[model samples]
Target: MQEWWRSAVIYQVYPRSYQDSDGDGIGDLAGITSRLDHIAALGVDCIWLSPIFASPQADMGYDVSDYLAVDPIFGNLAAFDTLITEAHARGLKVITDQVLSHTSDKHEWFQQSRKDRDNDKADWYVWADPLPDGSPPTNWHSHFGGPAWEFDPGRGQYYLHHFLASQPDLNYHNPDVVDAILETCKFWLDRGLDGFRLDTVNYFFHDHELRSNPPAQTRPQVMATDLYGMQKNIYNKTRPENLGFLERLRTLTNQYKDIMMVGEVGEMGNRSIEIMGEYTAGEHRLHMAYSFAMLGPDFNAEHFRNCIEGFQRGAPDGHPYWSFSNHDVPRQVSRWAEHSVSEDAMARLSCAMLMSFEGTIGIYQGEELGQTETEMEFEELTDPPAIRYWPNVKGRDGCRTPMVWEKDQPNAGFSTGKPWLPVKAPQAAKAVDQQTDDGIMAFYKEMIAYRKNSPVLSRGKTTFIDQPEPILAFTRKADAEAMTFVFNLSKDTQEIPMQAEAEIAKGNFAQIKDGTLTLEGNGYVYLSHTGKAPI
Candidate 1:
């Protein structure tokens, strides 16, 4: 039988910004437990929380110091256990972000690995020697900036870090490291966790030869960042050995009943889809995988269709998880402002389109309220990339602002003290209290309910219907119903032609005579069959 994730909608919750029960400025496990009703009301089948493990917060929680202990900044392990128990009691599955590609320098394993060579844990991390000129061993650059190699004075050698220098990449070639990670998975699975969202799954392995990466043959598909783009990134990441480790992780997850694993592949463009295909191709690997393809600023009809169809073409039987916004990039409503009729319309339309896709869906916190990216100043920056790149890259902290529940509440009920990031008036104005009815929040709730009740949408085969540019058209067919979805992705009005017998079924659509339908700028229509439906 197909798993629940095959047709489920998972919500991504950035714990630091979700809510604060202790008024500590940072969101915590108790904060999430209090907001369970808000998430359950959205009709999402599961909740995927970002890292909450023990960390120094150098890269926020991405640099995990302890794999098993919950960070005191977030909460204790008891708090996490209560969160899981309460979330399950409310009928919501919980998945957490797992950073397996690397460990924080403060991690015990890395600490020991850096304490000279020839120790028991010395081979746990990827460390190499410098060149004759005392330069980095390879030409590969870090995802953040500078060379991927960091010189550790303790070991008198360079350690590889695909991202920040503090986040040393793990050496998965060591069987003991693999076994330790699998045991960590068992720790969570034993605690009744539904699954994990593996962070940087493709970076789990690197070429053992430590070869220099080749330069890009074509203009790299740059995603608003120049770092790690000019090179082909062949030798540093996405090694073939990574597949065997994924199979091992999958084998561990399969021991539990209905446990699922979804990996985050960090490659750009269609390569992300290719990795998703490979990682989830068989039952021995991940149950599903997601990429940054839709999280960026691309919003045309062709781009949307290509992302979904690309995955389908790559792995016909593999499952996929889709999201437009996360803790990483700018909110979709603001990122796609060029194509929005208005922020309100864009948020509603985006929710509709995401739910109509052929895979599991994830709605990041505050996305339901149509949250816009906070315009933060240099002084307000907490992200290292933003601090380093300054004006060039605004950084991800803008989109990672605190969630606003009430307009009048302090910090929008996210905290009692000052929030980690300032809560702006523009964002507070669009809070949940102001969005009670006939608002984007309401539209999100209704759309999620609509997906649950509609058979064609919930359990149907998607068939692409050819349409013009900036207008995506597709049909979903089930046992007894067939539904057609159409959208205008531009700021200008477009005329949609359909069969005379086709009736407007979902959303507000004004039909015209002689098979001509007019859709206002960014308007969408979800129609059902009134005549013989084509399967």
Candidate 2:
């Protein structure tokens, strides 16, 4: 089978926020199955569903208790099978989030591991002896807050947990543990899953010596609400032993024809790009990897250029998947509001910019509708991080609100009952029911189609042209086909020297005359230099 993921576009669906068929105020598999046509119509090749495995809902299904079973809230195994069949029938491959770095403390393995040190599962989790003062094993801190080590009274030691105490990090140092993890993956592949999106792929290992990480010069990807980034995390994650486990996983996936795995590199800043390269540098590793580099607050052309160029310079043969918005971060339109003329313009510009990049593309649910972050009160917050650090952190509940499908219905037609997270007026106003022919949703459809049909944009090599700030220019070429893409990532009109001029194949708010390319605020243009123009 061909590497279908090399040029595929994946639509990410946060199942809990998508639809609720059982009126339980939470989205489920049946609800997602009912909405297959909506995803198929988006012109994307694959569907990436967030974690739906049997979890205790401690961290919204990411804290898994059973890797092989579907949670009751999402549906049973039979419902998942039906969803796979429906999605495949529509020529769409299905992938699910695999949270392998940790498991819920309620899991049988963890439960047994904590019972006695002589059990078969005793070494299944990362446990260490407390320091001289009976404190945590090290100076490590959890991504949520406080110490990364949680003391278990029965075990007489501290077990490592990168997130909440409910979610305990697995011990990849044990080969038996790796074997067990691969079996769960084999079970999913046998059920006809096309691929997997590995959540926090780089977090699968830790230094066994328990060396304390040094302090950092700059905490790039942290907020003041957490102290996890106060020191550079060298010992806790990104261990060299991680490659062996990834290779073992790749070997397992290779057994099933056409199965691919895209990992989520759990890092930030330029270092994230370097890790992405290493993880996807060879065929024996991940098929592709993505990080939170582009998901942050940077909106300038230099930042975008450096990210793309850094990935290329780090690993020439590696592959990357770029995304603008997801459940964890604020929406792109709302996050970069100061750089665009309006919400609609920013949405359109983001779509055009993301599609023009060279790699597999992912768009989160409701992003096509230009959905902004839903402001939530402390009482309405359920995310563990936000609830713990209320006023300062302002948790991720705002980004994880339910998707809006109707304008005037209760809960915006997302649910007959009150949603898990309230769907306010600002979000409901951009409902699917109220979309116009030239609306943001339509532009997403157009831009996605434009990318799907263009080989240069998908399979071509990129060469960026140096320009001033807020002016991003690049050329993609494959065979006789070539195209130049330029975007004015600012609120003011700007002009640049036209490197090459062709017909405006697809895009808006730009013009070309007298060797000058003029772009209005948030303007973009697709200059096709080949006979085969964009659709």
Candidate 3:
């Protein structure tokens, strides 16, 4: 059977900010179900939901207390089932966020593990004896801030947490822990979940020797709030043992037909591409993997080329899921604003470029409307990293503000009550109703339709062309179908001599004149050496 996810276009829905049915200021599963039409109309194949599992909301549901139960804030299990049923009815597969690396400190297992050294679940979490001076076991730092180890008075030892102290990392070294998490995965799969977006896939295990990480070879010009990036982080995450667990996950998902698992590789720079290759290199591991490489502030032609070509070189068989924006990072428009003439132009260009890539693609909620990040004051922050580092580091709340659906309605029709995060005028101005005839929205719909109708853009292999600065060029080929794609990455016009054999196949916002392809700022075109264009 054909794997449906290979060329699939997925839409990500941050449940808490998507829609609210109860008017309680938080979005719910029922509200998501009500908005299924919006996603279906985008011509996407699947919906990847951020975690809606039971949690303390310490890290906004990244700290899962019960993997099997739905959080009441997002509605109950019945509502979740209805959502699955409704999404499937609309031909949309559901991929849920699985926070397998850690659990809320309030979890029953964590509660049991912390009580004593020999409880039934005592080895379920990564607990270590304190140093001679009662300091943390290692010098590893948390991703959020502070040491990665937390002290447990009852057990007379320290437990590891790569994130918040309220969320403890699971001991994947223990067979029982692995078995339990696998069972949790099966529980959801048996309930008709299409697949999982494995959160922090590389942080499944820490070094058994509790070694300290070496200092980073280089530092950023801007000192980040957490010095976690100041070290190489070898001791804490991306251990070789992670591969075995992923294989186990693959084995479990294999029992169900066409079930896909896309892992999130939480590394930075070129190492991220290397790890993405390792995790998804073969049929026995993750179906696909994504990294923070594209989600960061890099928007140049060389950076994009290196990431894609690097993946091809590392994992010849591995598949990648490319997404420019998600709930975790700031939205793309704001991050790459300096390179574009206007926010709307950048938004349209992003959709075109991402869809043209050769792998699975994801569209974050509100991106289609050309939504910019909502600027927030320190008091309005919810993300942990931003809260700790205040003025210097703005948290994810800026990009995670409520999705705007209506311009005239209260709270932009996202909720009947006040939203958890305010919808500022800049974002509210781009609301769905107001963008009905908006150029950016229409361009997105057109681009998505064009990608779906063209085989080369969806499944073809890529070969990049060497071009001047601000001009990115590549050719995608699948069997007899071959198409060349070119884009102007800056806010200035660029001209490239067209290949003698190349002809305009299907294009947008670009023109061909005097044997040279003229691309206005943020313009793109697709060329083919065939008969009349189909799109």
Candidate 4:
């Protein structure tokens, strides 16, 4: 089968916010099917839907109660079939989110497992004996805001939950659990689904010994809200066993044609890249992997360079999926506001930079429209993290706001009724209908077209140029075609001396005059060159 995903641009759709066909203040599969034209117009090759599986809505469908069934809130199996068909018709592959790491406490397997220690499904989840004093298990901490272990009086044991207490981590140590998950994957594949976006892929397994993770050498003050980050996270997740499970997943996916699996490496710093490398090292593992490395607050040349370079050095054969914004984090336009001249400039620059990178690219919904994160009051929030952390964390609700389609329509045309998340003035201002001739949207369409036309940007090898602060420069060289990409990541104008036999692309922002390249604030340029000197 062809490795189509290698250069494919994936558009991530957060179901609850994309479009709501019904007036339930939520988005559904049918709503997504209706908006397929917008995604098709953006020239994306695939659509990665966030979790829409049956759930108790504890973690917004991340807590899966039924892996094979679609949540009623997002329509049923019939609706999902229609979505797959419509997406395929638009020449776009459909990849749904697969939260394999854990399931909702309301799931039948979990219900059974928690009923009794000697039940048939007793080992279906990660259950451990409490300490002698009746305290919970080891020092493992949940990513949400509490201990990783949740006590169940019925089973008289503590169950491991990397996220919410309601979202219990499955025991991958059991072969049955692995087999069952594979079967669930097969169910979707049989339904004409292209592939899956494995959620928190690194957290699939935990140390059998139940060992406590050691403290990190240094805890960054930036992520202080997440106490889980204070530790090295050695024993809790990204265990060696994950590779075997991934291989098993790869083996299963191999049975299908052109099927791909992109695992989400939910780690930070160099370790995240390392895990991405390991998980995608070869054909036997994941087709590609992505991490939160670029989703953080750091917005500099060195940071971006390190992430791409680190992946290349760590896993030369491994593939990577890069995205600046997603459902979990704040919008890039808002997150990188300090470095941006304006939100529009940042949006255009982001597209230029992400498309020029040599890997699979992902664009979250509303990004093409230059949507900024919506500010919401405490009562307006739906995300658990935001509700718990409140003022300090402000969780993912801002980014997960409704997709604004029309400025005049109700709820920005996302829904006829009230939206689950508010569409405030800042976000509604960039509505799709209003942005027909918008610079950011036009740049996105043009840049995506440019990227698809040039194989070098997608398949070439990346070579970074050592330049001063604020300027990021790199050359992407394929067999015969080579292109140099330069960006001013800061709000200040910068000029760099470049000696190259290159012609500037017409639609690009920056220009080269008198052998000197000048980049305005948040400006970027693409240079096509057959021969090159210093870049």
Q: Highest lDDT, which number?
A: 2
lDDT of 3 by residue, 1-535 (tens): 5599998998999999999999999999999999999889888899999999999999999999999999999999999999999999999999999999999999999998998988899999999998899899899988887899999888899999999999999999999999999999999999899999999999999998999999887964355655898888898999999999999889999999879999999998899999999999989999999999999998889999999999999999999999999998989999899998899889988888998998999889998899998999998899988988887888899999999999888989999998899988888899898886656777777778888888887788998888877878888887889888888899888877754656776565688887788888998888876532212
Per-residue lDDT over 1-535 for candidate 4, one digit per residue giving the tens place of the 0 to 100 score: 4488999999999999999999899999999999999999999999999999999998899999999999999999999999998888889999999999999999999989988989889999999989999987789888888799998999889999988999999999999999999999999999998999999999998999998889876985455357887788999998999999999989998999999999999898888998899999978999999999999999999999999999999999999999999999999999999999887889888888999998999999999999898888999988887788878878889999999999988999999888888888878888888886656787788888888888787688999988988888898898998888888998888888878667777324577788888888998888888887347
> Which lDDT value does model 4 have at 200?
95
Clashing pairs in 1: none
lDDT of 2: 0.91
Model 4: weakest 10-residue lDDT segment is 500-509
Return the TM-score for each candidate structure: 0.97, 0.98, 0.97, 0.98
Kindly report which residue pairs in candidate 4 clash with one another: none
lDDT, model 1, position 191: 96
Error of 3 at 238 (Å): 0.8
Point out where model 4 deviates above 4 Å.
Answer: 220-224, 506-509
List candidate 2 segments past 4 Å from native: 220-222, 530-535
* lDDT for residue 101 in candidate 3, whole number 0-100: 96
- Those runs of model 3 whose alpha carbons end farther than 4 Å from true positions after fitting are 531-535
Across 346-371, the per-residue lDDT of candidate 2 in tens digits comes to: 99889999999998999999998999
Q: Tell me the lDDT of model 3 at 189.
A: 94
Query: Of 1 and 4, which scores higher on TM-score?
Result: 4
lDDT of each: 0.88, 0.91, 0.90, 0.90
